[model samples]
Target: MNRCYLTARGMTVGYDGVPLIRDIALEIERGEIVALIGPNGSGKSTILKSLARQLRLLGGQVFVDGEELQRLSGGNLARKMAVMLTDRTKPELMTCRDVAAVGRYPYTGRLGLLTDADEAKVDAALAAVQALELRDRDFNAISDGQRQRVLLARAICQEPEIIVLDEPTSYLDIRHKIQLLSILRDMARQGITVILSLHEIDLARKLADRIICVKGDTIARCGAPEEIFDEAAIRELYDLDEGAFDPMFGSVELPRPMGAPRTFVLSACGTGAPVYRALQRSGEPFAAGILYENDVDCRLARRLAAEVVTERPFMPVSDAAFERALALMRGCERIIDAGVEIGETNARMAELIELARQLPGYNTLLN
Candidate 1:
């Protein structure tokens, strides 16, 4: 018995006469949600398009439930897989419900009138995406977010065992993004496999059971998010040298200002995070200190601060660390105290605060 619902073997994909990615082999199990992540122009969409049968596969074998993709009839393919592509195409005069109900065409007999069961599924799909209000409205008249939801509903009503979406959250607001992804999560739990490409690494980290890294004319890597999202992996995958990507938070930070320190900061916990960004935007080289290597503040400071003085987590601030921080603090012309909790382990923070008070220009950014 094979639990593998989708398999790609020796896949070589590209547009006419040229291959962008080659020799790819991967397997996706039933009900698992796999996310494709990579930097721009790395062929994420090209791969999705090939898998969805929208483009010619230069060379490869794609199997859906052990049946070769090319061997499947159009109707058979539709019954097994549903795709929501990146392209936005709308038909004139078709209502949202009419567009959505089209997914049932594979299941409909000749004459194509909507049966009660088909209509019920269509309605349910629309409601699932909270787009039922637009059901009667013209598809071309809806907003991009609404249109995206309708397209998703159309895919849902198809009720295939596998769903592939490419950058589905591009036009959606944060709320709608969460709602759509939650629905996809629910579907995967109910034994439907999902493959999606996301620009939102955070969302991918949260929702995907596995992540595929596409890069440089091949599948760079593929594994669980934990394996693929460490600082080194992300930096290499994205070829990022000027910015920092935090695997823990799935957040990205721009390059810090270069050269000598212009500002000093007193912070701990997560309090220093905003100050880092603020300093970056202001184009001021800065230094931050007395942060634990494992602190949330340290995670960000290491990227945006010219010098970040760090100690091991759970240890008291040592005299050497305090001296280093003080020297760096006095070198700066401005000081910002990002109010943090004063606890036994970080009691030396009080000394930094008094130092901030004595500094010529000092203030608390936030409490």
Candidate 2:
């Protein structure tokens, strides 16, 4: 059974004495990756700062491994928690290796010098984050992505039970983001708990074991990704009235073309995505049909087109579905066959192709 490693009970957090987030309660188990997500200015940073002991709590308390936060000495707390803030402030006149060695402060002697073991830990951390080559680079001279990796190496060298990071991926590119998150996942599997705030809901859904929604003045919701990543929940959470979000693939779509559909597209097996995107970019009102609900094409179709004709997943196109599609096809000014494969499951699609060929405006897109 998993044990609660860190928790907050009715915690109120903010700058100085003014509370920005209040009545927040959360429990995290050892080795679990918890992601805090919300809209801009929703106090995600404030909550993380408070939990990391950078900002004082306005009310209530936080606990780590059953010990009250206020009761733990600074050194004791340092052993239990390590924090990396999102601020882009860079250290000057120091090498990347020197910065990563700072995590050993809690274990260092009065002179704050790294012992042989401490140096080994720092070297291992740099290696873990794939920043071994940057060990000799100037901290302020490195790119944001490199700096982030170095900071993560620092946090890892601390060997703390819980690591709190505020927007760790803010400056990272896609490759570094994937690499860094992979390292975090590996660390968690080894029994290190991670708490982080993220602006990317897609990454959070993929990486987090549990998610916390911070909005207004409180924690809006908290649960596993499956419970919190539904379309309605995400759409409402981010107040997305202009665009659409597909919870199935954790993708956001541009608002569909307005007005009546003028074109009909027949596509499947991920082929519709490009056509849907092309139509969307050209601001052409469109409809897509004869798709199984679970197909990748169907996912983009519902978001980009004015109408999407879909059937149950794994089932062949039904008469009712075909009729709806035929009616849509009749209304369209042009029909573009996006070259869906003739297959056993969707052999009924042949009828639609024949109907398209007889229509006045029929086009087939190749490749």
Candidate 2 stretches with Cα past 4 Å from truth are: 1-3, 313-316
Q: List the residue pairs that clash in candidate 1.
A: none
TM-score of 1: 0.95
Residue range 1-367, candidate 1, lDDT tens digits: 7658999999889998599999888799999999999999999999999999888888989998999987899999999899999887969899999999999989999989998999999999999889999989999998888999999999999999999999999999998899889999999999999999999988999999999999999989899999888888889988887447878878888888998998888888898998889999989999998899988888888889999889998898898998998888888888888876789988887877787788886877764
RMSD of each: 1.8, 1.8
Question: Clashes in model 2: which pairs?
Answer: none
True-structure lDDT of candidate 1: 0.90
TM of each candidate vs. truth: 0.95, 0.95
